[model samples]
Target: MTGGGAAGLVGLVLVSHSAAVAGSVAELARDLAGAGRLAPVEPAGGTRDGGLGTSAELIAAAAGRANRGAGVAILADLGSAVLTVRALLAEEDALPPLARLVDAPLLEGAVAATLAASTGADLDAVTAAAEEARHYRTS
Candidate 1:
C-alpha cells in the first residue's frame, strides 16, 4: 500500500534483523519517494517471537506481499540477513518468481530501488538501481 495502486510496477521487500528497523526504513523510504511514487514494499524482519534475528518464513511472506505481478526486489541488512536471503535464493521455488536479493546499503538502496520501480522498471532495473546506490557519495 505504498504506491498509487499502479499495476505491474516492481515491488520491494526489506529484510532486517530488527523488526522495528525494517518497518521504519520502509516508512522512511516511502516518505522520501512520496506517495504514488513507489510500488508495494514489505518489511520482513526479526523472528516470530519478536527477537532480533532473521526469519526465512517472514522473508518469503514479505516477498509474496510485495509482488505486483512485475517482480520483487529484496534488500537485506548486513550479516545473517544477507545470509538468509542467499539461502532462500539457493532453494528451488523458495522465493516468488523473479524475486531477487539486492546487495546494497539498506536505506539508500531501498529508496533508489523504490524510485526506480515507481517508473514501471523491470526487476533487473530495480535491482540495478539498488546495487548502484552502493556507489552513492555521502560527502
Candidate 2:
C-alpha cells in the first residue's frame, strides 16, 4: 500500500532471528536488482533493530503498503519467524494477509521469495517453491 512502486512486485520481507540474515537478504536483493533483477527485499533482524519485533512490524508495514491492495507474503527463518509474525498479526490487526508460511531452505527461501515476488509471483507459487525446497528434519 505504500511502497510497491519502489519494490516493483510483491512486497517481500526476509525474516530471521539474527539481523544479519535479513540484512544479507536485502543486500542480495539489491545486488539482484542491480543485475536487473530488481526485487523488493527488506531485512528484519537485530542489526536493523533493537526493539522487540519493532523491526518485524516495520517490515510488515512496508510490505503491507508495498503490496498495494494485494496481500504480502512473509518468508521467515526457522520456526521463530512464523511465531513472531503470528504474534504481530495478533497484536496488530492492520498487518497484510500472510499468504503462507515458508518452510524450506532458509536462505534459499528468502532469496527465492524475493526473486519470485519481484517478478509478480503469487504467494502460492513462491510459498510452494519454498516448501518444495524445504528440508527440515522431522521425526
Candidate 3:
C-alpha cells in the first residue's frame, strides 16, 4: 500500500512504455490517494520513453519494489505491454505469492483502481472492476 492507514489496503503499480506515462500513472494514483483513496502510488519500469515496455526481468525487478512488498495491481499501456506482462507471469519462478496480474484500462484502470483502493478495496476486487471498466475517458 501507499498510505499509512486503510489507504495501504491495495497497492497500485503502473507499467508503461514511456517514463512520462509511468510518472503520470504515479501522479494520478497519488491524486487518488490524496482524495482519500487507495494507497500511495507505486510506479516501476518505463523509461522516459518507456523502452522497457514489459520485459519479464524488468517487471520482476519493478514488482519487487512495490509498497507492502506483496500483491499489486499492474496497469499497462497497450496490448504489447500486456503481452510482456503475460510473459512475466509465465516466467520460471516468477515473483510468486506476492504479485499477481490485474488487467484494467491501462490509464483509466490505473486511475480507478488507485482511487478505489484508497477506499480499502481488495486487490482482487479492484482488478475485477478495472477489467470490467469500459471506454474510460482520460484525465
Candidate 4:
C-alpha cells in the first residue's frame, strides 16, 4: 500500500484530535520507517468539518483504506479518539479480523508500528511493537 512491495505488510492509522497533528505524526513515522516497504498509513483526525474532534466514520473509512488485506493497527492521541475507534470497530463487524486497537504513546507507537510493518511484521507483532513503545525512554 505504501511501499512498492508492501501489499502484505500491516497497515497503520493515526488518530488525533487535530488533522494537522495526525498528518505530521504519520510523516514522522514514515520517515522513521526508512526505505523498507511499508503498508499504508492513514490519518484519521478531526471531524468532517475540520474541528477538533474524533469521528467514528472517518476512522472506519481510514481503517478500510489502510487495511490492504493484511490488517490495521490504530494509535490514538486521547481517550476520546480511542473511544471513537473502539465504537467504530464494535459497530463495524466487516472490518478485517486482524485489525487491532493499540494502547501506546501516539508518536512513539506510530514510529514503532511503522518500522515493524515496514519489515512485514504480522498484526500481532506490529501491535505489540506499538504497545512496547510506551516503555521507550529517550535519555
The per-model lDDT (C-alpha) reads: 0.88, 0.59, 0.65, 0.85
Ranking by lDDT: 1, 4, 3, 2
In candidate 4, list every pair of residues with a backbone clash: none
The weakest ten consecutive residues by lDDT in model 2 span: 1-10
Report the poorest 10 consecutive residues by lDDT, candidate 4.
1-10
Model 1: per-residue Cα lDDT over 78-132, one tens digit each: 7899999999999998898888888889999999998888877888888889999
Every model's TM-score = 0.91, 0.68, 0.74, 0.91
Clashes of each: 0, 7, 7, 0
Candidate 3 residue-wise lDDT, 1-139, digit = tens: 2335652566666877776777777886677557643464566656434475555666666666554543567777778777777787777666544466676666667767776677666677777766766455431
lDDT of 3: 0.65
Q: Tens digit of lDDT per residue, candidate 4, span 56-127?
A: 877888888898777899999999998887877786574566778899999999999998888888888889
lDDT of 4 at 128: 90
lDDT of 2 by residue, 1-139 (tens): 1234434355566677767666787787566546553555666664244643335555565566546334466667666667876676675455666534456565767666666655666667757655654543451
lDDT score for residue 104 of model 2: 59
Which runs of model 4 end up more than 4 angstroms from their true locations? Answer: 1-4
